[model samples]
Target: MAPALKRSYQFVVDNFLKLLLIPTALAISNKYEEIMHLCNSMHFTSLHLLCASFLIIYALTLLLVSRPRPVYLVDYALFKPPRSYRVSFAGFMEHARMGRLFSEPKSVHFMMKILERSGLGEETCLPPALHYIPPTLTMAMAREEAELVIFSAMDSLFSKTGIKPKQIDILVLNCSLFSPTPSLTASVINKYKIRSNIKSFNLSGMGCSAGLISVDLARDLLQRHHNSYAVVISTEILTPNSYLGKERAMLLPNCLFRMGAAAVLLSNRSSDRRRAKYRLSHVVRTHKGADDKSYGCVSQEEDDEGNVGIKLNIDLMAVAGEALKSNITAIGPLVLPASEQLLFALSLIGRKLFNPKWKAYVPDFKEAFEHFCIHAGGRAVIDELQKNLRLTNEQVEASRMTLHRFGNTSSSSLWYELSYIESKGRMKKGDRVWQIAFGSGFKCNSAVWKCNRTIKPPAEGAWADCIDKYPVHIPEVVKL
Candidate 1:
């Protein structure tokens, strides 16, 4: 058994003996009282004996129910950049304009400045096919890109698992911006020819946090159905939605957003235990609606210029800080080490007595999580989150680099971050990872995954090849 498991087992064994002593001692004390009462009142022996037996059974039941059950992560997969793709901020800008806009001196200068700073400026660019198409065909291009990325990801993931698509019992797809006539889930079903009776769900408008929300939903289904597998696909459509013209707020999305997707397969069957990594540990969701002031912090809207865009307000960092505190408060009691919990409680008490407004210092999370996959919304957002969480540069590197390389893939960005870590060969057996994302509805969501075992890393998969020189320090802002 692993050292941690051994420790847990020892603790349980020690506690079990103590617990057993309590019932025996209580029963002895009660028996004396019963004996005295029986003699004085002439009560029947049968009634006293029955009452004692009931007490013992009830106490044992309580102990059994309170003991923890081990939950394991079965298997996981991620999609990222292929090795041949490298598009700098300048290159992306130049390509996105399709030569028409880049022909202008100002446009060329702006693209060059941005590219020089962006890490990708020095890297190789992707195939010509990945560049932006004409304005009239933007929608068509968006759909094609969406299909290409998603299918490629799913194919790779399924290949790794050796699980036939037809064998999957549940399918869940989340894409926040685009939902065509036949949803992406339907497309998957048709392409793979999954069973007609397969249960499926498509989530739209749930924003970036929707990936965890989908995992939460899938977990519930797995627990209820038993012995079943669920496949989840997450992606975002970036072509038609690309913002053009000079609206600063509208330009933000164009600057940060990128193309990517991820496919994950989850199963509860005990037979397939060895292949899984990062058993689902916990999930927490917090939502503050649009009416809330914090809603504007990260929401998308049309500016006074009549251009539609997403606004990355400053207040979002503060709001996310508070939401994280609440989430940690709830999750801590469940997973925090005993020593940390005691310290945290003491700190809480000290704050209440000495400084009522004082924010309690959260425990060092580096002790708990080996990897952190924060959403790659933008450079500023990634920087703020790292400082707020007290994360190391390396800890936030994957998120920063993912944004720098692929831009924001919306709900699926977390997967790309995970891919970055994997591509670097950083993951190992029993490593714990945390994924946090903030999205529309002013929502902040988190998922904790603990790897079951190390497996072969996927090459020629998603972003694996492009990550070595990523996270270019781009200064010039280029519209997508």
Candidate 2:
């Protein structure tokens, strides 16, 4: 028996005997009282009382043993990809030209010419008004860009799911940097004309990992309500916060962030299982805040050159590895097969006993997951996670391609990766997918999904038409 089961069994056994003895002793005392009162024969009365006591104790024990155990179950899966998707090169160049980041109008013209040569210019879907701004006025023009991108993404996701806004029981929105006065959730509710009874929550500043965190919250709500559906929208805004100055700390965002968003529908109604792609399996969250070294590894700061920049330290991969280790340690025992667990345990013991300084044994993640979605925070983050998890190039390609095509959409990045998989027609029934994300609270959160059926990729989906030319092998730049 497992240790926990054994302990519970021992506890019940010990308590059962004590409970039985209590009634028997009470019966004997009652018999003594009857004898003194001359109400009945002591032996007969004692036997009668003892028999009744045994029945009561037996019934109580049965009740204790029959209580139900808590089981986490998922019943519906509705995936949403953004409606309007734009490439980073187009978005960034527009921002640069308007913000006057380039001194000469010729530089803006040259960049656009290069994009046209690269076959990307024909692909841009930005508004015409955005293109007429001079290089010096880009910052002002970017004010509503994030909102436009988010609305487009949400509109697509909601429409594809065929979920009427009025039918949604709960709404959750996560945007790390932008939480407007009316709030994004309010905007969604207004746009959809959702029912007034719908519960809504808006999460801000939770960082990229907040996407999974929101999913976790939605799962809890579904489990409690059983038949209700929850809508989760994840996106990042880009307008007023656009940095036009030469601050390196701010410059990283300019290069790294692009417009994207995703919506997901979750439910606990068993009737919806046939249409769902995956069932929620498990969610694990771990925060490593006290470790200052890891916290600062990928943070935004001002460089010596006075440029606001996001520093991608060489050691961030190592930091992410540590976070993944902590997450796996908590998650492995729950999902890993017994044979794999045994091997992992033995490997761990051998490493500790033979060489304390030896690196911890990393499990073969392929044994645990059929597909993997590591957050596309950056190229280096993805590469490091691939190495640490021992994942194949194919498994990591979905993330890399999403990053290459969309940049970091913060919390919404994972959905793009999933969209990539769907667009390629790679998801299969019974496959297991794992999503791991790292973010600002120095938080690492993961979710596991078990595919319920083979899903046909969406026709007008975010990556549906563009996945054929992806999985680009962008070589890592080696700094001298």
Candidate 3:
């Protein structure tokens, strides 16, 4: 069979149950008149009416009981560090030189080049421990950074939502590289004095996309338990994970990743809907870990001198492309309109059946979402996604601006992008948002949200101080 025939056949096979429903409905419609006549002839007695009512109620109860619970976003908070923490490019270089981590001049030059091309602006901040000469990487210092970043965001979140720690029934936190003993979740519980019985989870080594994974997990927990609230914190602690290795691939992270954290509150209580910011619509995740190339594309490994750092494989972009292709394919049907879906399918089948030169249709995601929070990982990642998705600069303004102002903050970066959009007062009730992120597991994750209410510019947030200055022009490369 031709490739088109095979794909068509597989589509049918995959959606057999849905296809079966159409014919079954048609057959029922053909017998509709007969069924109505039979019902009219049999329902004359009071006992019969009572039996019919009971059956109807039983079916309705089953339907209600089987459906998943709705999840609401109560509120969220982004860490706003002190102005004293901000680090300029010159200050960063001076600190690096003071640390004397790079033995060779070429390595220093490589780092400077990476910094120039990196999308980060002059105001991005680093942890206090990193400011000292021969920067401190002690476990104690790492804990201090973690506490400050996590607690600041959480405190703001609790205050904004007006919810006490005792109200939280579930806690989920993710920090990709830092998972000390007693766990980050335990730290939150201790600080907040949460209930002893709260279900808590701490996920580490999940990489930049871990924020959505935490959200997905919290949603699942909310659905299982009624009238409960869950708190999810996403952050990256740089003190322990900062690469001191002179390897160029390993050094790229030092130039990009910065200190940041975000906290989000999720609730399943029906009464909370009136005050919620957004409603969770969909969560789709795609993992390409089955392929060896994809599995090893981004990983933390020890170099020749036993220095640990996250290495970016040369094939990282190609692997990310494959993961994104798989992810969009899964999410397209869930979010795209029926007309767009039909056009995309027909276009693909046509190319396979007729001319291979025919351009394949890329469904217009703008039709589904009013806002896009593409993870602010780096300049190249954002550029490629914008070109492929055919998004206008205005649509991607939040992502680009977040990258410039906050740097690549790993798992928490998506929240910063969302905050940027909110800061610009672009979020209106009923509008939809799509958040996309990539991670070291060579995974692509997407979350769709519908605004529950019109959002005003925040009085305090990561963007509150400088949002007016942004949508700044960032050149392809800085000549520095």
Candidate 4:
């Protein structure tokens, strides 16, 4: 047979029984006596063989499709700041230039207050620029910071996975604030000497959710390019993009955003299944950029004094809530259990038909996922998500601890939270993890991962030092 005809024959041989079995079973009620009589008269077991064959085919096909060779997360690496980089609340106040810029006595006091109650631990690291005589945002400083973070994470990731830079077929790097002249993609390739033809991308201005976006992008590419490996690097360069202004909104990013990065390796090859740590199950990204409220909520621009800073609007939480609602709505059908789906549908119907204003039900996501990594942007962001999702303190512990220890690592925060969970031995084979992030553009994106094998905490991960002491109490108000 010709190649096309052979393929058609094989497809029919595989699926024709699956198609024929259901209607045959359904027809049994009307034709039961006739079929039995015909079978007995003909002294033929064709009917019995057909029924048995259909059963076998149906079961095999179900199993085959259910267990697709999903994209595998071979391994990941996180950038852990050294002890010298670690800072206390007092150190941040003295070095961050925020205190010097806000020389007025009252303004300084307010800034100190915000840092104290920011839910960040004393160990969060500031960038090298902040330690200078006068805080620097020079291009050289940005390059140094970018190189330190990106190289560190990638080196560790390559070492752990035993995958060389030349082996990577696709590279996606995300840095929200820093977009240099040569571009980060060129920098990474030139340094590593990757093959000239390797596909590469340097994504800027994606904010905290850029990591998920990178994963989504990689997943799509892997689907088109078989047996390919993709590397995603998520980092934020704080030196040049550091907000130096004293505006409360601008200053918030300074206290919250920290220096960190993560490198993840994803492979669609069948050989990767045995060694891979997690399988990529689902990725849902929702953009509210078209809406004025979500679009203007988190924006990076210069202030009246020509000081460049990211201005976080007061309605950020509300905007985030709206974005999250849209995200879960799209993802719920895929992950939610039948019971939760049915309840949500009934409640939605009731509100539309009866009350017309009844509070719509929020499907319990805890039922869908074994672990949750909510965005670790800030205390307010985590607190609001916890309340909105009705999550327990334990459920949000990883997120809160990631924020406290690493502060807001931008696109890398969710990975830090996932590391926290793994460090505590919370991840198990077949377990599902939900990672959700909110970034600038008021975007909320989620990626679902299923543990492919027993996950062991990496000895050199960011949480290796303090994972045991997390979930600590934080006072509503603290004085630095």
**Which candidate wins on TM-score?**
3
Q: List the residue pairs that clash in candidate 4.
A: none
Pick out the ten consecutive residues of candidate 2 with the lowest summed lDDT: 69-78
Residues 287-377, candidate 3: write the lDDT tens digits.
Answer: 8889999999999999998999999999988888889889999999999866568778999999999999998888888877999999999
Using all chains and alpha carbons, the TM-scores for the candidates as numbered come to: 0.77, 0.73, 0.91, 0.87
- All models: lDDT? 0.71, 0.69, 0.91, 0.86
On a 0 to 100 scale, what is the lDDT of residue 344 in model 3? Answer: 85
Give residue 173's lDDT in candidate 3 (0 to 100).
Answer: 98
* Superposition TM-score, candidate 1 onto the true structure: 0.77
> In candidate 2, which residue ranges exceed 4 Å CA deviation?
1-143, 297-315, 473-480
Listed per candidate, the RMSD to the true structure in angstroms reads 6.7, 10.4, 5.4, 9.3
Measured by TM-score, how close is model 2 to the native structure?
Answer: 0.73
Instruction: Give the top-scoring candidate (lDDT).
Output: 3
lDDT of 4: 0.86
Clashes within 3 Å, all models in order: 15, 16, 0, 0
| Candidate order (lDDT) | 3, 4, 1, 2
